[model samples]
Target: MTDPVLRLEALRHGYPTPQGRLPVLDGVDLSLSGGETMALTGESGAGKSTLLHLAAGLDTAESGVIEVCGADMAGRDDAGRAALRRAHIGVVFQQFNLVPSLRVGDNIAFQARLAGREDPGWTAELADRLGLSPLLSRWPEELSGGQQQRAAVGRALAARPALLLADEPTGNLDEASADAVMELMLELTRTAGCALLMATHSAALAARLGRRAQLRGGRLCDETGAAA
Candidate 1:
């Protein structure tokens, strides 16, 4: 069988406080294969975001293992981690982190360019599929919230990453816009055969994924009954 695209085993992490270290994630385990989607759900301060960040190599775990595309994330240095993220991972957040200075076309192509695998045809196809072809010439600030989020999705998928990590990607949009963006995101992830792990509070959104996992008291509970 092919190896899982992402795997976490006995993962633990915490933050320093005046009292001591405040635990966030404790012994969380998960595995995701290509074209699979899992929703990470929990309440405020439940460590959902922390898990995503650790998985993306944006932050280090205090203990246990985080493997991306069969590579141990803890084994890589800062530069190596950055290289790994650029090569195999894509990230999106509630705040659309588009480069304001660049036009929409350039913004969508940003990550692919950084990865040194920019394909104009693929980028153009993504823009068209995202319904941003008309706005490609415009700046991010000029587009509506939905339009901007669509562009963000396009940007994340521009490089055809092995894994995609999204944190409350539609939190800023209205219900209609959020649904539209979610549909496109789901469709595109399947089309690209990328593994997606999204942290979201909305049950409606979580229900759309292939699997669901809840974060509670620093541990993970698989709602799908596969594992935890």
Candidate 2:
């Protein structure tokens, strides 16, 4: 049997402040299934990004366990974590994080190359899906914000990772562009059977994900679940 795409147990984290320790996540627990898409929404400073960072193993939690695809993140060293990320995890940040020096096609294929899962055909198909086929030779700086973001999504999906963690991926785009990008991302993830967990501030976007959870006062509430 396959394990969950992601799992967190009793997660607690905080940061040292000028006055004292500022708590972020407090004994939080969450999970996402394979091929599932979940939207995480919260107010600024509510620790949504913090939760993603911990889930991605980019930051250490004060305590708790994070399991991605059945492996325990808390047990991995830096190299182990890096290897895990390269193997099964893909991250799309708000900034698009494309390689400015690489051409658009190369940028989209970069992570797949690093993950050693390069599939030229799939990458080309993704480019077509994202409407980036015409701009594949262009540089990141030359593309519009929506195009850059589409390239970022392509890069993350090229690896065909088991899980995709997106941190406000459409936050930089206009409303129309945001809607298009979000739609494409969801479609691609579903086709590729990749689990998606996106952190966003848009309630409308969250509602489209089928499941929406909010981090409120260090607790994760199933907003849609509550409604249902």
Candidate 3:
């Protein structure tokens, strides 16, 4: 059988404060396979974002293991981690980190080009499905919050990465817009058979995913509050 798309085993991380090292993630463990979606829920400061960052290889863990598509992330440098991320992972941040200088179309195609997997057909389809075709030539500043977030989603999935990580992706949108974005994200990821791991505070949104995992006391638990 094939390996899981993302995995974390006995993960631990902490931050140094005036008092000492305060633990964020403590012995966290998770595994996600292809075409699966998992919602990560937690209260504020529960290490949800920290876990996602470590899973994406954007930050290092104090101890334990992180594997993406069966490749271990323990000894990789920044550049190496970046290479792996570009090749196998996609991320959508709450802030919608689009390139201000690039037009919407270019932004949508950015990650795919970086991964050397750009396909005009797929980009065009994404633009059409995301309702951004008309706004492709417009600058990001000209778009509203929802539009900008849609562009960010397109950009992240453009490369068809094996795993997708989203941190509060709909936090900035209104109720209607958030629902629309969520629907599109779920549809696209499902169609592409990518693994989705999203960090969210909304119970409604979390329920939409196939599985739910909550962060508490630096570890993950199931919807019933049992250890995951």
Candidate 4:
């Protein structure tokens, strides 16, 4: 059997507030397998983004373990964690956070180059598949919203990471554009055999994935929890 690409064990995180430490994640546990996609849904202040941040190694958990691609996050220092993310994780943000200074093609190839795994052919193919071929030399600020989002997706995938973490990746797009980006993301993740965990507020978007999970009271629960 294939090992899970992501595993969270008894994770807990919180922030210090004037009142006290307001807990965000508590005893949360999850496992996601290769090439499988899971949707994370919840209302505002439910800690969806907090969970994604911890999984991506952008933040440290106050307690518990986070394992990605078999390596325990708890065992790694700051630089080690960064290296881990660079080598194995791809992230898409809600804001379409592309480098305005870099051209479309360069942005797509950036992470791959950092990982020392750049493949010019694959990068070009991704640009073509994403319909960004013509915009290769254009800067991100010159593109439309949909175009910018597509480029973000391409940039994330170019690294061919083992796991992909997306936070409301299509939230800024119109219905039609959102649907197209979601479909393309799934298609490419399947082709790369990458595991996906996307946090979205849209039920329709969550329904498209293989399984659904929810964050409530700082806990991670299955679809059944969505009812509670």
What RMSD does each model have against the real structure?
1.9, 2.0, 1.2, 1.8
Question: Candidate 2: global Cα-lDDT?
Answer: 0.88
Candidate 3 colliding pairs: none
Listed in order, each prediction's TM-score against the native is: 0.92, 0.93, 0.96, 0.94
lDDT (CA) per prediction: 0.88, 0.88, 0.91, 0.88
For this target, which candidate reaches the highest TM-score against the unseen true structure?
Answer: 3
In candidate 1, stretches whose alpha carbon ends up further than 4 angstroms from where it belongs are 224-227
**Model 3 C-alpha lDDT per residue in residues 1-228, reported as the tens digit of each score:** 998999899999999999999999989999999989999999999998899898888998899999999998756988989999999999998888899999999999999999999999999988998789999999999999889998998898889889999999888878987888788778866888899999999999999999999999999999889999
Error of 2 at 208 (Å): 1.0
lDDT of 4 by residue, 127-205 (tens): 8877889999998989998889888888888888999999999887789878877887798668888899999999999
Q: Which stretches of candidate 3 lie over 4 Å from their true place?
A: none
Candidate 2's displacement at residue 33, Å, is: 0.8
Write down the RMSD of candidate 4 (Cα, Å).
1.8
Encode model 2's per-residue lDDT on 1-228: one tens digit a residue: 788989999999999989999999998898788778999988999999899888988888999989998998977888888888888888998788899899999999999999999999999988997789999999999998888998998898899998899999888778877787788778866887788899998888988896788888898987643421
* Candidate 2, position 203, lDDT: 82
lDDT of 1: 0.88
* lDDT tens per residue, model 1, 1-228: 988999999999999999999999889988999999999998899999899889889898899888888888877889989998999998987778899999999999999999998999999987887678889999999998878887888898888899999999888778876787788678767887889999998999999999889898888877754446
